[model samples]
Target: MSDRYELFLTCPKGLEGLLAEEATGLGLEETREHTSAIRGFAELETAYRLCLWSRLANRVLLVLKRFPMSNADDLYQGVLEVDWAEHLEPTGSLAVEFSGNGSGIDNTHFGALKVKDAIVDKLRTATGDRPSIDKMNPDLRIHLRLDRGEAILSLDLSGHSLHQRGYRLQQGAAPLKENLAAAILIRAGWPRIAAAGGALADPMCGVGTFLVEAAMIAADIAPNLKRERWGFSAWLGHVPALWKKLHAEALARAEAGLAKPPLWIRGYEADPRLIQPGRNNIERAGLSNWIKVYQGEVATFEPRPDQNQTGLVVCNPPYGERLGDEASLLYLYQNLGERLRQACMNWEAAVFTGAPDLGKRMGIRSHKQYAFWNGALPCKLLLIKVQPEQFVTGERRTPEQREREREQAALGQSEPEVDNKKVESNQAPAQIEQARLSEGGQMFANRLQKNLKLLGKWARREGVNCYRVYDADMPEYALAIDLYHDWVHVQEYAPPRSIDPEKAQARLFDALAAIPQALNVDKAKVIIKRRERQSGTKQYERQATQGRFTEVSEGGVKLLVNLTDYLDTGLFLDHRPLRLRIQREAAGKRFLNLYCYTATATVHAAKGGARSTTSVDLSKTYLDWARRNLSLNGFSDKNRLEQGDVMTWLAADREEYDLIFIDPPTFSNSKRMEGVFDVQRDHVELLDLAMARLAAGGVLYFSNNFRKFQLDEGLAARYVVEEISATTLDPDFARNSKIHRAWRLTAR
Candidate 1:
């Protein structure tokens, strides 16, 4: 038998048991479990095997020796006393890692420096030449842990963080760590997943982490199959023949256990930016033939017939904290719930959320909720069982019925009723109509209201469910447009026939001339801002060029649009169908919106009898316009507005919203934030954050206008990202259908 030694395997928090199980499977004897670590005793060959097959461990360390150290000199002496020649070569490069809390050697770097010096000094004294320090990709890694007065030293057998499972060649923003992904699959019961023959999907899959993990589990492939080397390979006592034999034997065992394709695995998202990296990761994992990735939205995604089984859908959606606001996130969650109930009936769903209130909006009670951590923030992963029978009716139950059921259930319990009066007494009055305008501002508001009425009538007369409403009234220079649904079919207009600069100018004036008198806007108030589109500068330009337009509105909340500004200055015509969708479904639901550009959807939701509304965005200017829109429609300020980063906000909030709308900019660069945000690059983190805060039975309507967007395949397991692009296009945009893709996502 090979020499036996004690080992401590470290894993991400909550995965200690999994690592212990893996170690035991590899013939190691588990001795104990710590908070985030597992200790075991095994022969040197078993240690090599553990590094090769374990899925959830971050690293495997071989304990060298333990000693007591009260000062920095003691630390040096303890490190120098170890048999350095047993692990390090005189010509090799090494790195030392130190971790400890509440110790005299508190600074990890300083401790590491001391350890490195001692190792080199001991080696030089024994063999003249000492090993060098290599911080980046070291050949041999040493670990030092000092807890209280005790110090322990070990050699890192896993060269890199095991989370870097060799499957991913590329990554998108905040991709799920591989070890964490594997743990989630395990927690959700992967054995059951394989038996069900249902697809594994993540509708907001980013970087293919989930897809690869699923494939690995399905194929019985060891998670580290592709890893080229481990830190143990460079040790002085390394046995290449033994390790090779162990690796080859494990690979053969895994190959023998491989079965036919388990289920159809897929993912979808609206942003194209994630597709390449996702594909790269999938290909690197050797799963290019098993999993497929598509670009679409969750709002209208249809599951394949084969996927009709009660499979799992897991998603990590944006929480609106790093993305936008609670109200917008609510809108997104509501839409997600609606779509899941409509299309993916047989699927079991799991959503990882940091916000408990948002999880309530999924409408379905969770069969299991597991608490985990994404970085330092605490989060919950809710597993919801969605029976196929629940999809027979398209409509969600009324809010009154839902509330009544909760009350009855709460009262039916035999437990004594606790006094809840204090909770109610401390609650502020529901601020549903707090932002409504007074009668004094009725003149211009009335005109805008009349215009909305006319627009709705015209939409109905023409059977147009969606169209743009441009009010040129002065006070606000920005444009105010609404995407109406229900009455008018939203249509995507073809790229306007390319017109000569002069002709475009004439057309702008003509469209402006059509404003109705009841709306009461003078032509003189319209000024056209014009310029030329520079080469690289054109993409970044926000102002209109070669257009007949002028600043018309101030704070009065006027809808002044310049058609000459690129192609879409007047309105986002795609959401007309979605807004109508909200109006048809919004009765008696609370709404949340994030990155609410102008709150047009809020107006529609309120009109549809929404109980309350909250809008969040980074721009105070847009929030002001949203407030104006609510007031114009006779809706009270009961709707709240907040200006902050959505990610940070959701991390701390606990409120639940029934309807959510998430419409963020295609790309934005804020000096105060980390860096510029590209919707395609950041959708996974964004969707994860959003789903965390949705209320049960809620709907989330998420969209982005990156014309060439493609979806990430890993997200399919969490969200059923459906393509609602066909329904979102306006009639005017028939010539060019690539407007925007909208999706709805829900837990499981």
Candidate 2:
């Protein structure tokens, strides 16, 4: 055999540079980096040492031969010329793994079969016996990578991937592979910290992968020392003496490292079931004396090492996949930041996560960030120094107080000291993060105050308590602030992709800070929501289960609004003018409300002395809500709320109505409906059905919120159609004229 061998080390994506550095440190020569892999040259002893000590490599491949090939025949001939007897016994089992597709062999399985056939035929001719295939524990494992019409055949020296360190038998839902965990540790500077006798802790440790890898690093233990089986264990070229010497050296180093004082390494998991499994893994790695795992939550996690010793706090929190999950995980990240600030002073923190947006919500600034790939998903590792200066904290001072501080500074007087006791107590981190506002935030606050002063007079004069005060007044702060009695409902428009997420988030925080102070409302009464395009029933889904309703008045009618339950607060404030028009014109006439969400307009028609009222909707939940509204107004006798598909209901109803109001959703795909509802496509049929039920000389009021809606040209020819969209706009909705479109249709 040769004294020097060409070696290739494979790893997870995005770790090629780090692995190259590690391989060079481990005595590899002429290192070259590729995508997810590294190529180098090493002596037989160094190859054995790499197999024993490499923590970032997934596999260590020993290149045997490189040849040019263009077809399957060339592939077969290359393997046949390798002289199989020198590498494997005739009766020994082997497995072939092929990667890359080129030179007309596009299928990996077919390429592997072709290689196996060539090897078997060559060994049979040479030794009169063919080798059988044993895929699981093969005596020899050959890897063939075809790239750019070149075939590179190699032997896998490290079996079953170097990541399988033979310690972890049980893992959690989403466990990081051992090699990736080691990469994260190295990037977090764990090696230098461990050498300095520092400590390590993972607050959200799942199955203790970080703990085990860290302890092994601090104790100078070879990761694969306890492994029994390897791809080169039964190879014909195996050097027993060289491997033995290297293994002995590693054993001596471990023994000597263990004799020194143990470092402080610990992990805390919230799941009780994982505690035993984590401990078992640590014990199997033979680091039980150095590492310990306990069942604990992140909120109360306190790492008490030596008093003055500082270390690293590393964790991988869950990245939620659903929209609703982000709401709850937001608090989890905030709590983690709070605990770090309170307990881990002066320590370095490394938070690895797939959701960088949630990571920003932690209220701590990270000095450095590194990008990594966990399988196919992109992730980030945020490095922070847990110092007092890194904490985002300040008291929320008013404009007067800020001006006073500036004046005091000008007069050679010291600014008043903020009470640190409140911040250090059990107060929420978000509450303590009320720092000085930016110039844009101050301008936003001024606009809000100006809007309140102007709209307040209009609202009280019109007997309106729930009106929109501000709607995207400035482009930078994209939000709609509506007042419902003393509460403020703020809906932030989702920013476009061109906007930076961190800047948008900061602007949102500034807007939220300015809201309560500008409107003179309690912070608890401010309901914030993110507005984006909705499909199916997402717009109707309840955001909270507060189950509390508030009574409000408009045009001599009582209504109930549930601000916390849904995206829309029961009442459609933009349609106030249309509802009032229906009430005024419904005297002594039968009224029909189609697609009645909560029957708010139907209640107005009933209160306007309509002989009888009927409302149709698909949601039983909203039907129940409509029933409560009628009961709250004491007009349940002549009012009828039917829960069914509007299109299906309109087909079956033969009763004529003197007045009709139809407001349909832009799109709906509820399971209870036979087919999806698209207002743009089905409006003509809907309007035709409702017109057939309308009494002669009566009016049909049609409206929708679809901005792209085009009225059917055939309908105007069939009836006298006049667009009343401009007349439906109240002063509160004048800013957004396209909020809804209305039309008054009369039979000719």
Candidate 3:
């Protein structure tokens, strides 16, 4: 067994320091932070100890070779020159992993393929046999990272992404990435809090990542102890006896550290869906006895009896990515701030949010703010220091006390009084008119106002902006839209639960049929078109039959709508304000519409005086409809349509546009595309490609419906993101304000 080996410990961004500290604690030298990775030299026993103890790491890789490669041929030569048989047997299966930026080789799949070919070819020529390629459950997983022109290949010691700690039994719509969650906990200073006997609590703990991570740190449990296998176990150089000895030592260390009664760690969430996964994750971490998971709202939670000791309250609250409105979110934050100040006096609080403006509404000044990437979305973990000594020992008043003082100060102040007799004389007839408006159709308007108020109250208290509003008899075709300040959230509310899907469909169709009635347009001025949902085994087997309607004027103006369709008419009504913005801003400029489903905005761009428009979409059917939309808008000759892949096309195209609208599906996988397209994971690449074709001073309007969509922080340096969700919301959605987050990106 070697006393020294080059080790590359990998962690999610912002966690390299904690992992480095952990490595140092294990007697390994501190090394530099690479892109989502850390490099160090440690003994074989130290490597094993790291695998056992590191909480924030994703995987540990043992460096085998580092060589310069100017191009693909150089990459092949360098990989082939390495001694493959010494570590991996010819009969064993192998997998290649690729990462890093600014490489001559840009394509990860291509780079991985080249590396695999080089390894196999070298083994075949030398020993007349080669390892089989197994992407899933490979015996030996190799990592090839090309930074600039330098190629560094390593043997993956961890079999999977360190995030796969074997605890998650189920997941919600958008669960936190495990490694990222661990990084968040570490960033919030969990180790120090744990050592000081401060309790750790997650108010909105989905799947209990924070709770589990806190418990693991408190108990000194090795994060990877539950993992059944590692890539190194299959390596030829791996010594079973040495590995056994290291494992035994780790077990003894864990046992020795278990002397104290478990630290107080708990997680709470309102949704029942999160309970099973939360419990499963805690149990999987072997901290079930130490941590407890419960289903409840954050507003009503009471701190435990040990209030003398400082505690940490870390929460990842919903940013209205899926539901609710801005007004509600503001109120929610206000109430949340009040509750935290009132209920958790001695506890320090850290709230992680991708949206910063909403954090401002919490009214608590953050002591420290750390930036992190939540799968490409730039998120901030705001830490608020809440020391009881400040409240008890200071002459300064609490925020509540200040409010009381202000109210007392206002007691002596008075506004100018008007003559009530003269005011009544002037307003008597107006009051009767007001009574008439309130009694007639104004009754319905009053109901709408009252409903909005009730919905607003519920949305605020629930800490959500997106929700379903149950009401009937207003504009049945109208779906109220709201955009929360944080999370670029979009929420749509239809009539109450009494109106079933079929009834809603009928009402929607009637609304489409009556666009002329609602908007006071002629039937001849309206042209309706339908969009078929994409089909596959999943969609076809599910029998998901749905289509949208596009109404066009006889004079060539298009009005695409989903009046008769199920939930949302394909057209987002909240963006009515933004469509007007396009008309105002787009002038003599080339426009690009990505993920352009119905191309309504494309029409608006053309009408707004754009010189030309190029629309790219994977759906050929939608592209055809987009063309019709152009024709209806009398700008058929002013637009170009492409019917293939966006990612591939963007990579190959050299054309630049002055304005680009990128609104992709929340989640989708097309047959033509290589893999599923996740807005969070693929945003950086998509934005990079889009920006590559953007002219100087060009603006890109990027939007997504992933409700919990987070923008990647690393990409922020390249483009500026401004939240336009608030300006896009329509009046009907005032109750739950987050309709969609729209950003105007300008290249630096």
Cα lDDT of all candidates, in order? 0.66, 0.87, 0.67
lDDT tens per residue, model 3, 1-748: 3568888988777667777776788867747777777888887777777776676678889888899877888888899998887877777799999876454677888899999999998777455677899998898999988776788899888888778777776666777777677777777788788888888878788888778767777777677776778888888877788888878776776776666788888788878888987797677667778888889876656566664656888887766552223334444454455456555765788888876666764545677888877777788998887532222111344566545434532342111111111123234322222221212234444554555477667556644343333223365534332222111112224456676766554443333322322223332333222222332212212112446454532112455543333234445645556666777778999989888876778888888899998988887766766777777667878689887778998999999999998987766776788778777888889999999999999988888656678888776777787777777654445544644677878988
Question: How high is each candidate's TM-score?
Answer: 0.56, 0.72, 0.54
- lDDT of the structure predicted as candidate 1: 0.66
Q: In angstroms, how far off is 99's CA in candidate 2?
A: 2.9
242-349 in candidate 1: lDDT tens per residue?
988988987886676454654678877667898888888888777777788888766655566643355678777775552113333443454465556545655677
- Candidate 3 TM-score, true structure as reference: 0.54
Residue 565 of model 2 has an lDDT of: 76
Q: lDDT, candidate 3, residue 30? A: 49
Cα lDDT tens digits for candidate 2, 1-748: 6889999999999899999999999999999999899999999888888899999999999999999999999999999999889999889999999999989999999999999999999888543778999999999999999989999999999979999999999888899999999999999999999999999999999989999999888889999989988899999899999899999999999999888899999899998999998898888888899988988888878877455778999999998764334334655676688788667777899999998877776767798999999999999999998764555444455566557645643443332323333233445434453343446766898899898898889998988999999999899899998999998888888899999988887787677766766787765578877789888778889887879999988888899899777888899999999999999999999999998999999999998999999999999989999999999899989898898999999999999999999999999988889999999999999999999999988999999999999999999989999999999998888889999999999898
Which candidate has the highest TM-score of all?
2
- Candidate 1: segments with Cα more than 4 A from true spot: 101-103, 125-127, 257-259, 388-748
Ranking by lDDT: 2, 3, 1
**After aligning candidate 3 to the native by TM-score, how far in Å is the CA of 278 from where it should be?**
1.9
Model 3, CA-based lDDT: 0.67
lDDT of 1 at 316: 77
Looking at candidate 1, the ten consecutive residues that score lowest on lDDT are 429-438
Clashing pairs in 2: none
Which whole-number lDDT from 0 to 100 does residue 359 have in model 2? 78
